[model samples]
Target: MTNFRIWAVGCIASFFLLGVSLAFISMNDQTQTTSGTDDLYEEIISNKAKYEKPAENAVIDKVWKKTPGIEGRAVDVQASYNKMKKDGVFNEKMLVYKRVKPDISLEDLPSSPIYRGHPDKNMVALLINVSWGEEYIPDMVKIFSKYHVKATFFIDGAFASKHKELVQMIEDEGHTIGSHGYLHKDMAQMSENQAEINMEKANEVLYALTNKKVKWLAPPSGSFTMNTVIAADKLGMETILWTVDTIDWKQPTKQVLLQRVLGKVHNGATILMHPTQVTVDSLPELIEQLKKNYRIGSVPTLLSENR
Candidate 1:
């Protein structure tokens, strides 16, 4: 009985010693980790300015009219530190690049024709005006899908009503739909009331189909007057023009289509195109090349103030 009691006591003492040692080791590791974290955060804060950038505000240009603002970036020290803490390691990949907004947004600018996005915004938009080429649209949508790109399609009102399935397909593929007028008439010749009626009629047809109010209008054949602009603005839509014209309606060669767009491409450039054979053939290569340097986006995304 005495021998058993001695052995039991020895085992209990050993267990207590082991527990204390483990607790000390744990405390020491925790202290070291905390110290490392503090050092890391301090380092990041010190070097924050090297990576920080200022935001560019939207401005009204004498020639371009309303221009979009490019979002800037800044290192968020506290947020980054917390992220590192949660991750339990120092990782450059985990650093948070928070967006710095501009003082003047797109909405702050006066209502006018938007010809291009902000020059500082490293992005491009493909503006597809759909009127006649019902056959080529499927292939164009296919190419866009294959490249994982989204484009803005300014659909004609009559076309939208007649080809609801095609419009739905384009919409389903995550493309933005806008207005292209009802009769494809010259807005330059129409009076304010005439233009307003035409636009309203188009909007009605589009709304019935998409169930969403149209926010953009591309006047047919690039014909518009201030009266047209005023009418569109009154109807709560912005008139959009393109920076680059593919001239696909003229049936340029595939190489010509590519060069016409890629050659003159710049930040905030809106490439206007129609549903033509040249576009369908050049879209694949054009998108692949454009993706190498620029972020291809929809019109709404290109014009947005957000990062």
Candidate 2:
């Protein structure tokens, strides 16, 4: 064949191959989009209630005291189906929930010590009592900052008074500050009047530094009587305790501390820890692990009614 004829044949072959490839790509995309779409919306609507959960009301337990209400989950069948359709496949991630507010909220319940948030909420609060391990705080804050998590710190008035700048740095880092009493003394051993005075002094000191009134009080060593709770309520503050106690002051190894947390961790858990070498070593891994299953936030965030 002549040179021009050969060239024409080559051009024809290239165009044919390009057309075939484009047709195959379009067909494959169409197949993926339409695959498993039959009866998808019906399936979602039928199984919607199976996956849905109900709102739990705030309860004042004789032992657990004031427990916050949990916002319920209601499936949005239409939205879930639409999301799946957009993704061109079925995935559990495509599930959508509409929050169902509880009729009786935590505020409606009588005042008492709050130990944990709603058990069904997918969040946990880290309560770091600024005990004697002051040196480890900066490192803890750095880890929290790295993970974009916020925690609540309960500090003693004596420590806050001595290390004003350290306390201020904590508040500046966007962590919530709660009173850990004026002195590290056991408030349960004191009278209502004395406990009130101790709480007031701590509040006054903390307010002087942050210029923001503290609303939560975690009694030192979890030693507080019902009178102490009443005193805190009188001051417009809520008493808080913890669900998971790290007990790092006992000098548990880093592995043991993480194991304790992972073993006992649940929705709305209030993880209590102190600034210690073990905690600072365990914090980064703890936050990363919790983020996979639950959001790490402050006390107010965990107890909030919003989903």
Candidate 3:
């Protein structure tokens, strides 16, 4: 009975020792796994830190150095680059290093009379018809001078011949002189030959007075046929029409004239008026109001800027 009792005690001690050894082995394996996981996590963090910041900085520096021109446009280019980078599409094809020329030319344009200057420019032109009202021109000139604005005056050939001094005065004041057709007749009613004759007649007189070639023609009463355009084109002149007409010739009140102009005026507007009392009186206010929203200049000046 004593020997059996001793054998039971020995078996119990061996079982406890085996259990402790297994527990220690299990803990060591678990510790080794945790340490391996920690090393891999630290390596991942270190690699990200080494590469991420410099990659972002490289992208920004490359985009900024390639963009040109005004700072505003450069900012736009950078924003586009940043967006492209976010999409993983940033490449050399996105850069613009030079000014691109337009693919269109004058011949590519539609064959219609120019009713306004370039639509891209925030500008308006005043086209004054000088068919009759010679007496009021000086006052109009004074008002234009006061506002520091230049206009294009389409002069009747007969009126221009009779009033060369006024034509010279208009020219000296830095205003443009265009043909209003000879005899102030409707160009649409005339033959091509007659149209050419009339345009040449007006051109001769204006050239004699201003010593500058006439480059624009406004058909009398805004009446023109295709022949009129052809005739003007043959003479190296472009036909111009008004986008906004004041109709001061109908002798409207100053308020009516002002309303007609202000209501329709916009960027690239070619405003038509005549040398009349109402137009002369309304000129100052019209110019002052338009200057707030538009750059007032001659047709050529505004058109060239747009090109």
Candidate 4:
């Protein structure tokens, strides 16, 4: 009887010990699985962070130093930096590394006397008249480069002749060059033949310098007649006009200029501006605002997308 009791007690103790050991093993396995899942989650988030935000050593600040409004001017860099941080969209680095290829098949567009680009596209063209403000061009170019923006620069023949190096620089930067008439004269007041002479003269200079044919013409002061359109068509250039005018030429305050642009801008809008102080001041912010809804590009880019 004593041997039987002892045997039963030993069996019960062994079973309890075995059960405890099994439970411990199961708990350890679950902990390892949970730990592995957490590690994977952290890795995924780290990988995403690598691409979503701009690198800490990005060259944007250096580029801004070369830009027009901020260069050689007393600008609060920290304030601008703080503002950019607050505005998440502006904080994103401009993805200018993407090279836009020209679509050779889109040569048949601008089939109208007055071209404002395709209204259906979610894009905007910046038309910068370069007859005056030679000092501002470099900064403007830098700003455009910083934003990876390609704008259309309409060169007056006189301006081109005096500033050939600047014109070459603009072309080399991959921006489109167009004619703003030979002498910034009103083409509307001239006869068809006279208009042709002005157009041809400007076209000749631009071609001589850039080796790229002028495909668009923005008449000075946006003044043009039927004769101007005929002359442009003869030269195989489209008569380009603006959908939005910044009126920066009048030297409006930065706040007012910004408000005017933001209030009037829409998809497929062509903004007319000159290389003025106001324009330089307003450009960076303007580009950021427009980028939210519209792809800011050259007129040719808009035309190609539409085609």
CA lDDT, every prediction? Answer: 0.89, 0.89, 0.76, 0.74
What is the C-alpha lDDT profile of model 2 across 254-285, one tens digit per residue?
Answer: 88999999999998899999999999989988
Q: Write the per-residue lDDT of candidate 1 for residues 189-306, one digit (tens) a residue.
A: 9998999999999999888877789999999988999899889988989999999999999998999889999899998899999999888988988999999999999999899876
- Candidate 2's error at 4, in angstroms? 69
Using TM-score as the measure, what is the rank order of every candidate, best first?
1, 2, 3, 4
- Candidate 4 CA-lDDT value: 0.74
TM-score between model 3 and native: 0.67
| Range of the 10 consecutive residues with the lowest summed lDDT in candidate 2 | 85-94
Q: What is the TM-score of each candidate against the true structure?
A: 0.83, 0.76, 0.67, 0.64
Query: Where is model 4 more than 4 Å wrong at Cα?
Result: 1-111
Residue 150 in candidate 2, Cα distance off native in Å: 0.7
Candidate 3: 10-residue stretch with minimal lDDT: 52-61
- Candidate 4 per-residue C-alpha lDDT over 1-307 given as tens digits, one digit per residue, 9 for 90 to 100: 9999999999999999999999999999989866755554444334433333221111112211100010011223334334443333333242112222322322333333444444445788899988999999998999999999999999998899999999998999999999998889988899989999999999999999999888889999989887887788888887877868889989999999888888988766788999999899899999999998988889777655332
Candidate 3: misplaced stretches above 4 Å? Answer: 1-100, 107-111, 305-307
TM-score of 1: 0.83
